[model samples]
Target: MIAKLQIQLNTALYLRDPQSTDLGQKIVQEGIYMIDEIGFESFTFKKLSKRINSTEASIYRYFENKHRLLVYLIAWYWNYVEYKITFETHNISNAEEKLKIAIQLITSKLADDDNFPGISESVLQRIVISESDKTYLTKNVDQINREGLFKGYKSLCMTIASYMLEINPAFKFSRSLTSTCLEAAHQQIFFAEHLPRLTDIKKEEKMYDRNCEFLTSLIFSSLKS
Candidate 1:
């Protein structure tokens, strides 16, 4: 097997770097599996320790709290998505086409990435769709934002928003539309799956395609002069 990928994260997210040691790496690898299997709300250091055959204190040495660990995972995901978008769009010249491709990439079903062996991007995508909001919905979000824990997500939005501006210089809501499209892409799919009444997408249709279509329509419509 290929060596596991290591993407350096913000130091503030952890008390110790989890990528540096075997147990630390296991903390991250199993953390992703456990979080995906259960969820951030249901996940706990005590439970994680039991699953990993480690102590809660050991987990604490890597992360101060479960919330911080969730943020770390989400941030890693945002960075990975941004990298994929940038890589895919680097050679594409048309701004409108680029945005469409970006939307498709953002909304489409995620595949497991080989570059990052320990974490499953598909599961991470589901987590982002389902639980990413919890990362910043807390009272301490302002403090964490100041610490740059959310920079990866913000950077992704900013980059995509820039694409909108290039397509329509007169459009004033590029950033707003960018963020809305990104969030709505996942949220609408979530709604379609469990709360079908909340979405216009029918249950019978290919859900990912419809979500992508909706976002593509929304973004282009908002950008057209």
Candidate 2:
């Protein structure tokens, strides 16, 4: 069992910090569960308020809107991912091995961690796989980014990109490569379940195992060039 995880995100993500109060935490916990149960396109704060038995006004106090709430949840997940990566790889001195460990952490099947009793990491992982793109695929992305809405994602990506450089100092496009690895980890699992035609993984092989193999080959091959 993982110990209690305390990930502090940027204050800009919320109007009222959810971790500061019980009602606020309920909004976040239920929001994650509902978004995963339904889909982001159909999620609303009204529905979320109903789930937590709080008025819409109460939820609005915590978040400007459900979109910000979603961003908050996504940010928290990325923070958790960074925490896991550090925990799993910090002791390893080998860059190749560190990169491999990082890939494994990102691609592995997510299991619930009791440490975070509010949000279900397993369910949140599903939301990330499906709804994460929505967080940035908007016309106001620049404005949102200017407000540091994507700091969590960007921070984690930079950490991984740094690992990429450790493995291949001469290789350019480390950031692109790092981002691609993150996207591929989510996209391939999504494609395997919903759009099998897009991926080459065999039916008998677990998606995580296949991705680990493919990414290992891809990362190593690129570094050798």
Candidate 3:
């Protein structure tokens, strides 16, 4: 998670408009697309400049370096996710519906064709696995943590727990279960890589839909006394 944290930290640096110019916004948008395509290791200012029809100097004028550009991209992704989730699921009234809608929204978003393809499993493992040892390299660790990804995750869990509670206030909503749900949402995308033995279900979009359906059923059924 260290590398992931570092990337998140770096991405945060570009959250604002440095010059309020059209070029700056374009740089941010195109940079995200490029990073999603090529990834942080292979992505460079020159490549981004070429992709966006801008000069390397122009990119530098907004971002200090490639790492900073990446930080911005990560931030943008999270911010977009937060907005999407809030807007899509906020209208549901019941806890069960809220939890179900939240999970559906999360799964749907991850399944989106436009999500950053540059973030491969190897890269994610490198970030999470190496987090402790490489913490110092990421200057924006505190800031990224403060950005509320984790908090947002916890809130989702609380929402789920609230729904579960509605069924039976005694139901134990352990941290493990919350983490399981969160990981399950992510696993829906990379299940082929993460759980190869679990059947190549993700290759079929129908399977994802079925899985979501089954997941909600299981959660609701399990909550019943």
Record all residue pairs in model 1 with backbone atoms less than 3 Å apart, i.e. clashing: none
State the lDDT at 112 in candidate 2.
Answer: 85
User: Least lDDT summed over 10 consecutive residues: which range in candidate 3?
Assistant: 1-10
Model 1 earns a TM-score of 0.94
lDDT of all predictions: 0.87, 0.87, 0.55
In candidate 2, how many Å is residue 156 off?
Answer: 1.2
Expressed as tens digits, the lDDT of each residue in 24-59 for candidate 2 is 888888898899988988999888878888899999
Put down candidate 3 lDDT per residue, 1-225, tens digits, no spaces: 123121222333654454256787677656656655665668798998998888989888888777655545444443444455566667766776666775575445353223333333333332222221232257776765675424444555665566567657777753455556555654544554466577444556465565566567657666673
Task: State, as a TM-score between 0 and 1, how close model 3 is to the true structure.
Answer: 0.61
lDDT, candidate 1, at 24: 86
**Which of 2 and 3 is ahead in TM-score?**
2
Residue 30 accuracy (lDDT) in model 2:
89
Model 2 has a clash total of 0
Task: Quote the lDDT for 79 in model 2.
Answer: 89
lDDT of 1 by residue, 40-118 (tens): 8799999999999999999999999999989999999888888889889999999888888889898888999887877
Candidate that beats the other on lDDT, 2 or 3, i.e. the better one: 2
Which stretches in model 3 have alpha-carbon errors above 4 Å?
1-12, 18-20, 64-68, 109-143, 146-176, 193-195, 198-200, 214-225
- Residue pairs with backbone overlap in model 2: none
* Clash pairs (backbone) in predicted model 3: 1-127, 1-128, 1-129, 2-127, 2-131, 4-127, 10-71, 11-71, 11-72, 12-71
